[model samples]
Target: MQWGCMDFRLLTFGDLRLVDGKGSIVPFPEKGLLSICFLLTSSSTQKARAELAEFLWGDIPLDKALANLRQTLSRVKNRQDELGIELLLIDQATVSVNVRAFTNDLALLTAVSQTNPHTALEELLQLGRWDFLARTEVIGGSGRMWLRTQRDRIKTQMLTTLRDAISAMSEGADATVIKEAALRLFEAHPEDETVYQILGETYAGEPQLESARHIFESRRKYRWGELPVDPDPQTLSVARRLFERQRSVAPQLREQATPQLEIVPPVPRGPPKLVLLPPVNLASSHQTAVFLSSALLEDITVGLCVLKTVTMVAHYTAEKIALHLDRDAMLERYAINYVLDTRLNFDGSIYWLFAQLIYAGNDEVIWAERFSMEAQNLPRQHREIAQRIVASVASYIERNEFSRDYFERNPEAYRQYLLGQRHLKRLDLPDIRRARKAFQTALKENPYFSPALSGVARTYHLEWLVTAQGDARLLKLAEEEAGKAIATGQDIVGGYHQFGVAKLYQGAFDESIEAFELAETISPHYADVIADYADTLMHASKPGEALEKVERAIKLNPLSPDLYFWTAASANYSLQRYEDASAYIERMADPSQAARLAAASAAMAGDTRKAKALVRKVKETYPDFKIDTWLSIVPLREQWQKDQYREGLRRAGFD
Candidate 1:
């Protein structure tokens, strides 16, 4: 190999792009480009002809594949001469790229290493425009496998580079770079708390305590509703102290400061702590009116607890201290960030209530409202008051934090949540077990955690469904977990949704619909709830309603899981729209799960050969999948609905 000055540059960060010295694109046929890119990115700059042939053309017969490889290689070689670049060093036994002949972006990035991380980071950021071969395609067999491997390798290297850069900053290199790196990590893993900790620590280390405190506070308020154990607790303490000192000093300087207000330090970490003070009875001392005030306070506390994004001091705790001290003293003693104070007045046949959400830190009114209701409507009035307060507090937190509910601050729980979701989404026996374990781990750390508990329940229900179990043990267990989730406030929407699934599978169609309605009321925009609700509707023989709900789910969650499409397909099949059902089934990511459904729909849609092929495929995986066994396990409530499905499968050759 002879070294020569060359103008061509191979950029392989996000995309497979080749730019000449003059920054002009050196276009090559897709085949030739793929061939050159493969060799350029491979180890030792070389690969055997046999290996190349197997990877690039393995889907075809050996002789034809080899001929195709030869043609591609010839085109690649011709491109070198055409562009006046020494792009390849070809031989009878193997082909290699002459690394010294051109400047490659990946090589330049790697050469600098991450020791000079700022430059390396800048390069990495620029290279992130595309994956290994963003717009390129590798059709079938070993070629697709090789492409995946290369893409994963490059992505791994980028992530490693980010970690290295953050490490360099932590070691006292460039503190400013920490923010940029942390934000980038946030972009990559928005739900991950570790990056926010890193960024927070970097700010704290600079004695920029306000920024550090803000990061953690905002993360808690807008993202996680709480953060993980602080990574640098000592540094975090120092930052909190500095913030507290500033708050203390600022209030002292206010000449007109209220003597009744006490300047209390904020909670060091976690979501805002709120306490609903016992309502003051303004009506004449009637036992019933006093009892109603206490009951109202309890009701409000329970409602706030359901919005687990905020911490609510228990009613017992509030009762013991709420009336004994001034609001500021209560804030200081209990470290309460907000106080919900209420006043109740009772006149004949009418109940009047005054309420306000106050910021304990400054005694500022965050929200205030008054309610009047007939004495008989006390229960409804209490619910309305609780809902209003919860919504107001949520909005207040969002306003202070300057973000939507995005990050999951509990790193450990969130990690487990992600792991469990991955396994649950796969919907297999072993994966369901893994998902259960992961969810269990999450609950172990935060026992009252709702999402993890919901996951555990979901996994149990999935296991029961997948195994086609006649025993209701798993279903019962799933129900228990869903109740625990709702009790713990995991996600009001998800908890009800899981509960609905348990009810649906148990053939309690009306109760299941009621649960689903509750979930929909809580989170109207939640796609998973909509999708699952659609599934329940389909089982209840309401195919039209099911179709509408499933379509709404897909619209809400444009990139929803394959199960959403499968539900849509099933709903369409139940509605006897075979052509539409076939179209939706084809869109499913894992069509094998719906193989029987697809085959039936195809047969009814007049695609006999495709239907026959799909039936054969289903038989290969499910040898014992008899129509009678399937019908027995399916949750369809109506005999007519079951018969409709039975006839379709019968048409597709399944007896």
Candidate 2:
């Protein structure tokens, strides 16, 4: 064996480890290892000997701690002969790592994090496996503080690495990189409109137009109650051109391109991917059907965008390429696992739409439906169809992705949650009770499942609303369960939504709005949260703002649930627009709440006969609903709107 040979190495990625060139673990006592790691990771690569001794052995007597430090250094110094390298340099005043003797992982990471992010990608990905000194026993005080600072520094460097990587990819031909970069940047800076502009321009197409418009409109409405507007004139022009091109494209391209189709590629395993193919207009007589189809497709895309477990192609891209190529070839080219196909048939005034979800792997149809509606009711129909499609698709994809072991372990809980969702969709009193039972059953199986907890809370709130009479006990139960939901799922969108609704029913408007705002921030495109927030705003005496939010919700979810229409009616009524309020009230499928609003609107508009008839209809269902109880249940802050509501009800024969 050679004497005075030096071979020092270090590892700081997952854990702190040191070795000689012979690959033998360096002989270090606990204090010595901690001291080495601390000095090695510190930015200055040095620290005062006394300061380190005090930090590491603070609880011991000062002189004793100093003696221990000296003894530890003595042990480390003695090992230098065996290890063939000086790991540390010590003086009476201070100590530091021997930078000239050993190579360090920290140094490598720091240099790469700033200078070459593309090369650092693998290291950045590996950072999660081992936190900085995660296994080390860092108790309270300076040690913990130092560890915290180091962790933060590592995080900052990781983000820097990602940013630099994105910057390097900015000039590449890969749209996927640009899209991912824009998405990551937005995650870091959500309110940056410049990033929004970048994403909008990068994905410029008909689909982008609708999404950009919705984003701009939603932000303006939520902040200032402004009317909806297009994002920009330039984007608007490009979108229109794309839409026209799609409408004018010849239908024979599918056949023409079939002979020239390239070999299909295999889809990679990850999250489920879907492409929503453009709607095929079967009746050709209704040119306006093109706009309606585009609108529905975009609405469905927005609805589905909230799902974390699914990836989707841009609607305009899907619409453009899908029609020109063979379906199998198109799916393969995009690596899509499922395709949503919609066909529209318009004859004179009536429309029939068929939607099907097809599995790309086996060319099997998973779900299909046919919807028939008149031209006047197409908007409402669109919302209904989109909601159903999204629900079905989400359920299908999630169920299919579950592993055998997961299903075997949690089948009952999963089944109960699905049943609860189905019952909740019915939006009736008996169905609400059924949903509560299902959710409770799910909780019994897995008490910590946030979705089940949120479901149970929502069912109680729905019971209070659909029954048209407030039960304080039901509201209390709602609050308890919603609190549990928030506790279990602090960052989940559904928990915040349920919490907001629970607070709204309790007349805690400020708290309700705050919770809803958090949910909206988490899922900005979620129409139900937006609609619920609008209702809270109406009760909080901000009818103008409420109307704006309701309209924006409708824009996002054009075929929204019946509750949205009821909220819209109430908001319009608060604004004293009896005609608009009556129009919206008439759209509600639930007769109990519908009659209450319709009677009030008709009475206010000087239609006594119709108002009295509607009041009789409401009394038939809810004979004990006093104006005071109604007012209490749906509290309003504006004195004038309250007076108007009471007068309307009184004229319609309610006491």
Candidate 3:
């Protein structure tokens, strides 16, 4: 491709391209091109040769990888000379990109975002049209990993920039700009119902009656089926009302109002009411078998109701409804939104229970699963079966309610709790504090709300974790909040789960185990609680059991978080399975979060060079890191466990 440019121009947002001053594309090798992209995008625009080599050719031997990197640099240099531009500044130990010599689209986008966000928003909208590194080929595992991380970072930035721009726009802002921004946001997150509301309001405000009707129509079609040939009067009234509201607000507050001041519909109604019917005896099993299945379903119903996010029909009422001939009539009478139906069958030796959750409005099966156990083992496995069904039903009901904009009792409290959850998941220090505040607000609205109370406890525990301060006060606060949660809502799983985490960090292994056991008894299929329980087990010097629990947690949540892998790695490391530890570390979304453990695992596995590289990374990331101080803060129950980790760090060359 030819470009009319007097200076080197690189584009890294959508594709990797380098155009020379002569308006011609530079013919560079794939590795060389990737190396340039890497250097430019790096935080410091510089990296150690060893680190660069590992990123580019980590699968090969270090010496061979270094040799390959040297050749790549030579090729890049030749291209730079041909273009008469000094693109790279190479030294004996490090490689740095001369960013000032070249103009890149990503650089421009970032600079504009700080100075002129409206312009930046336009650029972001353009860049979001294609994936980052869209045309770049990364062969090495480490290189591909970096590419994934970069893409995620860029996408998050785009969303943030767009939201900020939209928020900053005043009432007098151009309708076209607002429409474009909202449309892009909707396209990026099609599942967010609020985005649809925004789009509809924007179009309505523009007085484009047809377009406004179409936006809401599209959303309705997405959720339910097609509307009638003639639009419902209620739907038309909604659009007209929105237009009137927008025009009224604009004239009064045109100069002072921002997008946030735009009118939003009132919070939706309470959680969906669910009814769990008694299991049908499809196989003419013995009365005892029928009783067993009924008991299991009852337990699941109890568990689901205890979550307090869904309203469950009373057991006696559900049982009476199940016996009625006209099930539709029964469901309608109870105003049920969801129905949990099950059938019990026996194949001589094993009893099988098949369960399904159906949306009552449409009679659609939202989720279905089957469980089988030998007749003799039915009693022992009842809790496990019940927990699985409860978890699945709860998950589907929550998604259903969210998509439909329904909230639990005290909608404001639930909204704040959800906001806190979003911040907590980011796992950054500042966001964690923000999450705590959000949760605190939720508690002020409803002090006895179990989820919000648990959320508050989690923030304190996570703050203590991320800060690495070993602050006893944080643990105490977490413990107190968790205790309040349990006292207010005895059957809720989150209370017990957070209590276990606090106790674990406080070095109360026995108490921690007891709390986790109770949590598992309440909700065995909660993947996060199980994962945290696994971490507690590992710290309590039971690596075998810890590994088993973590593995189960992964099965329950196939897309488990980085913390799950970190726990698995720690357990494997304690069991002297160094290779397994390293493998688990590799699965983490950001291995740097557990760099010390990764380094130790590598050293124990006899990969001294790799271990030392990770050690250097740790030092670079945390300049004042001391092995003794870190180990002292780590809550390892056994002295030998601490000794083993210290020895691994020592061998990894950590001071």
Candidate 4:
């Protein structure tokens, strides 16, 4: 065979598919692909047969792994009497790719990219490939990270080189080249302010200001709200000035309201830590990426928050993790002992969610099974994931009776709480009220529905906390319901979290800690639990310990709610890391906006100007400000902590 004969047709880096020069397709499983990719990329003696066995089947028993490797080699299906062992050479204990055959894309791409970015990129784009699988997610820890770093570096280099080529184009350069480069950049990074700004400016003749501004605004707001300061000056200025003008005319024009604020206990401490990683997007699945991924993460987080053993990472926290698309790193950074990695595949009316578990210590996957249901099974699917996750960690709960104190409530009421969880995001007063009713109903249905009870308590907490929505009566009832929830959930971590919050609101300190500690013990992966628990400690004037829990929480789930980062930033602010605080807050949307508003206000506070402007935009985005009250409905796990948070907002001049 002539050299590089395998290049006539398509080459895949994933499941091995080799089409001979005659267009015959040969199927090669993962082991084969690894072998192929390795062989093609390696120097002759780099691919040892024994090493290949371990690389392909690292998790399997040694004997089984080696056996599989031999079987794979046998399937190469080439018979040779004299050069038989030539195809399977072992020189000095290293295997070699029979350079006598096989051309590979990965090898091809790597080689091409070194000398020809254009051809390499064109081929890469046309190939329409994602990075290799199984190995990316399944390799042992450090090795997996090394592979990721290498891949990332290559991609960054490709894009950088491509951009440099495109930018350095001579006046008569092919329009096709510029167009392709610009189009790819825009597609890959729609949220990059500078990219859009440049495009908008480049096409200024087309009146792209509004579009550019719109993109900037969307990206600006989409940040998880932990900014140390406002966005880029251009962005902050646009949003700030607009808000300032709106605020200037808002006293008598108040038809809208802010979220109600009622103090709950302080953010508590010792909350359990938990982290959720992005589910794999199945290759063949028809599921919509935006809704399912966000919904699944959010729902699971909220549902788990109801349990005491769970220290549920907040929705925003998971969102940050999802954006980065590094599930393995998330597990490591978060120090998560286990991860709930969910995958969805839709076929006809059935939605199959394959939720898999990876134990951090062993990198052992517990099982991979499909939870099949109709599209309508969305809620149930969330439940299924939650239940299975809980079940997987059940042994831990059993060994620690301290953890068991968290889930004695009625399952059905918990389900009602789950329903309310789904509705929380609709953000309409009616929806919020409906959510409240659901929580109420959960209580009515079970009376001991701690989540609902705590949820209601939080509702009241918010009603009293945010100045715009605080109604004393609303606050009182919230407290009343919260008290009931806590009593019912007395044994669960969630119960304590909720109860401690209520107690904190009522200025009950010692009790809040007791509750916070209980919740922390249950769901150790829940970062919000740690954040809130730490806040509680801070409220109780124990910033030292609060700091410690926050550290643990950050470790358990590094992709935090920008708020946790914000909290740390604020602590930095308190500690005078103005630059660091500013940098961190800049990474957030709401906090950045708030910082801008605060800065603008300082420059001018009775200035409802910023408030009105902020409110208008907030209203447009969240027409249901009242529903935000739900956040505080359950009493905080720590009331003093709640007070401190409220105080911080007040100090920041938030109404």
lDDT of 3 by residue, 60-103 (tens): 66799899989988888886677666677778899987777777
TM-scores vs. true structure, each candidate: 0.39, 0.45, 0.42, 0.42
Q: Which parts of model 1 are misplaced by more than 4 Å? A: 1-415
Candidate 2's residue-wise lDDT over 534-583, tens digit each?
Answer: 98899888988889998878654544567788889988888889889999
Task: Give the true-structure RMSD of model 3.
Answer: 19.8
Error of 1 at 624 (Å): 1.6
Q: Name the top lDDT candidate.
A: 3
For residues 1-655, what per-residue lDDT tens digits would candidate 1 score against the true structure?
2224577677764456777777777686567556667776665568888767865775456678778878887887787777666677778878877777777766655665734766676756654452466667666344554565555455455556656665544333444544555555544443334444444433442323455466566655555354221223433454475466446645435354321211223336665677777665554555445545565565346435434246666565566555675657656766778888877766676666677888888889977877763344444555556655655564322121111121133445545655566566466899999989988987776776676788899998989988876669999788778767765552345667788899899887875786777666555545677789999999999999999998887654444567888999999998889999988978876788899999999988888899899999998988877999888878898999988888889888997
Using alpha carbons, what is the TM-score of model 4? 0.42
- Point out where model 3 deviates above 4 Å: 1-409
Ordered by TM-score, highest first, the candidates read 2, 4, 3, 1
lDDT of each: 0.66, 0.63, 0.70, 0.51
The Cα error of candidate 2 at residue 528, in Å, is 1.8
lDDT of 4 by residue, 333-446 (tens): 655566566666667656666667667677788766676534334445555566566666531222222223233345445455656655665545566667787788877767
Error of 1 at 362 (Å): 37
Cα RMSD of all models vs. native, in order, equals 21.6, 20.0, 19.8, 25.8
The whole-model C-alpha lDDT of candidate 2 against the native structure comes to: 0.63
TM-score top scorer: 2
Q: Over 4 Å off in model 4, which ranges?
A: 1-316, 323-337, 346-350, 359-364, 372-395, 399-415, 425-431, 467-470, 505-511, 521-525, 573-584, 593-655
